[model samples]
Target chain A: MTGWLSIFKREFRAYFATPLAYVFIVIFLVLSGVFTFFVGGFYERGQADLLPFFAYLPWLYLFLIPAVAMRLWAEERKSGTLELLMTLPIGISGAVVGKFLAAWAFTAVALGLTFPLVITVNFLGSPDNGAIVSGYLGALLMAGAYLGIGAAVSATTKNQVVAFVLSVTVCFLFTVSGLEIVQAFFPDAVGKEVAKFSFLTRFNDISRGVLDLRDVIYFATLIGFWLFLNRLFLDNAREAG
Target chain B: MAPRLEARSLVKRFGPITAVDHISLKVEAGEVLGFLGPNGAGKTTTMKMLTGFLDPSEGEAYVGGVSVADDPERAKRQIGYLPEGAPAYGDMTPRGFLTFAAETRGLTGAARDAAVARAVHALSLDRVIDQTIETLSKGFRRRVGLAQAILHDPDVLILDEPTDGLDPNQKHDVRNLIDGMRKDKAIIVSTHILEEVEAVCTRVVLIDRGRIVFDGTPAEFRGRAEGAGTLRVILPADAVEDAVEQFEDLDEVSAMDRHPTPDGRVRFTLTGDDRIALINRVTGVIDGAGWPADELELDAGRLDEVFRALTSRETDHQDSNQGQEVRA
Candidate 1:
């Protein structure tokens, strides 16, 4: 736990030490606001819930989360600092957990900044706060899942752009699994199975004022599975070098 | 005392290229061992294996008797490694980077702060600790790297070219710092500069083409090329063979070389570590042989010559072996 916390602190401070965190937060806020109010027609829909805001989150994170997590290990490898970190006393798992938590927390901070939208909705209408709270919870969990994949991809290469593009491509696959065009490629039963495994479907279930135990386990399991792969990648690189 | 660091039959290969080929070495505590090799000589590869950054394809490396492959974390706890290029996050300042290293080493609260302070003070990074690493000079960046490596005060330090790009003053200070920590730790420093090794290293392991050709103290290494007692006599051109015959009875002067100069004088070169004895015998022979010589001097052995001889022979042997393999 201490090892993880130490890595987390280093990673968190690393974001602030440069212009990355501020730039990410600013871009995230402006885009989320623009997408929710203008693009998704939040005011036009006139819904009492945060449907417009939550709907754009998965898409926004697809690009923005990769931007944040792309450099986590890729930059370390490019700069040859990965060897320095790997030679430390901490295990590879600890380093992965530490880095993943830091990036996830940074994304949470970006998520938290959008609370004004919650406040704005609460003041103007009698929206169900339970659903809004669950929507935010789902957003946070989905971020962890996406960032876990991003972190795993980041460990595979020294090129940040390569890491970013590969992760975004993979995340896109998981996001569109439930869509009709994607499901059409599979047989009827397999298509249904693919749709059921889609990230959008599971995330949408929680955003609809329903926090199912299965959704929680799904996202957590996905995150854990990717994190395990991240560790394995790190171990392989350490041995290979 | 047991060796502070040891590698037994360590081997590493990348596809067909073997970087470190079943090399073994040991350094006792308080010894500054120089790792000498040319570029592409697998010096850095050996250090990485020792530091547990790269697992050996076969065999094992140990720090304080803990196997790097089996128990890397425990072994690494006793090691401080400064890799080539001394890479660190450019976004982080020295203070922030050192603090991160401290925290990773499990130092916390007051202890962490104290460790950071001590490292900063030791490296004299007062003015630059707050500046981003990207803005610092090469010397200051090297110091920051040194600071982090020593912050934990590990018992084994595996440094790859620690003073590669430093100014003379910075190099002196770094050498002194490593020397001062010698009694408490074992330091293995690799460098291309022979003077740096001569200044600080107590022993040296001269590696050539992934093999250790020489492993001994500095003085012992210099003593290798001392040849069969051969003497050169300097005399007038006509008296060369007479001077040589005069020294033939001396057992210490087993062989002789008398080369005639353009100026009509013969110059003799002597080969032997016992210069005084050789000189005395030559003088006795010269006085008895009635040969008048203009000048005689002793030759100083150069490390550059030794390095060339060692690396070239190894490369030639490797090429011949490959040629034979192709023929087969």
Candidate 2:
């Protein structure tokens, strides 16, 4: 546990040690506001809920989370610090989880900064605070899933650009898997199965304040699955490098 | 009672190419083992395996009697490794990086502070402790890497080319530090610089083509050359041909060469198995001939000659093997 905490602290501090954290937060906040007000027409609907903001959470995270996670292992490998980290007394799983939690926490900080939307919704009309809290929870969980995938891809290459592009492409498939346009290409049975795996369906459930146990499990398992793959890839790289 | 570091037939293969062949050795406490090799001669690969950074394709490595493959985390607790180039986080200050290293090594509270302070003072990093690593000079950066490796003060230290790219003063400082620490730890330092072997190592292991070609003390290595205990006499140029003929005819002199010196003197070098007997016989001849000699000296075996002879011989053997395949 101490090893994990040490890595987590170093990784988290590393984010703010450079301009990456500030740049990412600024871009994420500005895009979230733009998409919510102009694209989703929050005021035009005149509703007292943050559904407009939640609607664009997955798409917003598609780019933002990868930017945060791309440097997690890619930079370590490029700088040759991966060898140093791996040779430490820490276990492989501890390092992977520590790095993933750091990136997830960074994204959560960016998500937390969007509190103005919650304030605006409450001022306009009576709102279900329970749903607002669940929406934030759902967004954070989904970010963990995206970051897990990004961290795994980042471990496969030393190039941050390659990690970014590959992660975005993979996340895109997960986001749009349930859409009618995508499901149309498959048979009805296979399409339903594919939709069952889509992050959109699960994220929407939490956004609506349902808080289904199964949806929570879905995101948790997805995060665990990708992080396991990340550990395997790193371990293999140590042998093959 | 057990060796602090040991390798049993460790090997690493990448596809069809064998990077590290089956090689084994051991180092006890208070011993400095110098690992010498030519380019791509498996020095770094062997170190990587011993440090648990790379898995060997065959055999195993142990630290303090613990197998690296069986429990790498436990085995790693006993090692402090400075990988090639001394890589570190560029964005981090020396203080931040050392703290992180200390924390990961399980030091905390006052202990962590003390360790970091000790490393800083030991490497003389106080000047750049708070500066970002990328902004520091190469010497400072290398020292920072060294500080991180020694933060935990493990029983085993594996350093690959630790003095590479450092100026003379910095190199001297690093060598002093290693010398100080060798009293309680088993140290393995891989280097290409021949003089480093004489400077610090208690035993030297020379590797060629992923194999141990020579292993011995510094003096023993120098003794391997046939040119050991040669006598050289500088006579006037006019007496060169006659002196060479007379020296060659002596029973003690096995071989002799004469070359014209820049100062119009003929330099004759005589080689034989026994130095005292050979010099006595040659002096007798010289006195009888009454040759006008400017200087007389004896030569110890040169290390550079032995190193070149050993490695180049391996290359020649490989070249001829390839030639035989081409003809067949």
- Measured against the true two-chain complex, the DockQ scores of the candidates, in the order shown, are 0.70, 0.69
Over the stretch B213-244, how does candidate 2's per-residue lDDT look in tens digits?
88877756766776775889899877777887
**Of the candidates shown, which would achieve the greatest lDDT relative to the real structure?**
2
Docking class of 2: medium
**How does model 2 score on DockQ?**
0.69
Q: Which candidate is the best by TM-score?
A: 2
Q: Which ten residues in a row have the lowest lDDT in candidate 2 chain B?
A: B319-328
- What is the TM-score of each candidate's chain B when compared with the real chain B? 0.76, 0.77
Question: What clash pairs does model 2 have?
Answer: none
Q: What share of the true interface contacts does each candidate keep?
A: 0.92, 0.87
The C-alpha lDDT values of all candidates are: 0.85, 0.89
Cα error, residue A20 of model 1, in Å, equals: 1.2
What's the TM-score, to 2 decimals, of chain B in model 2?
Answer: 0.77
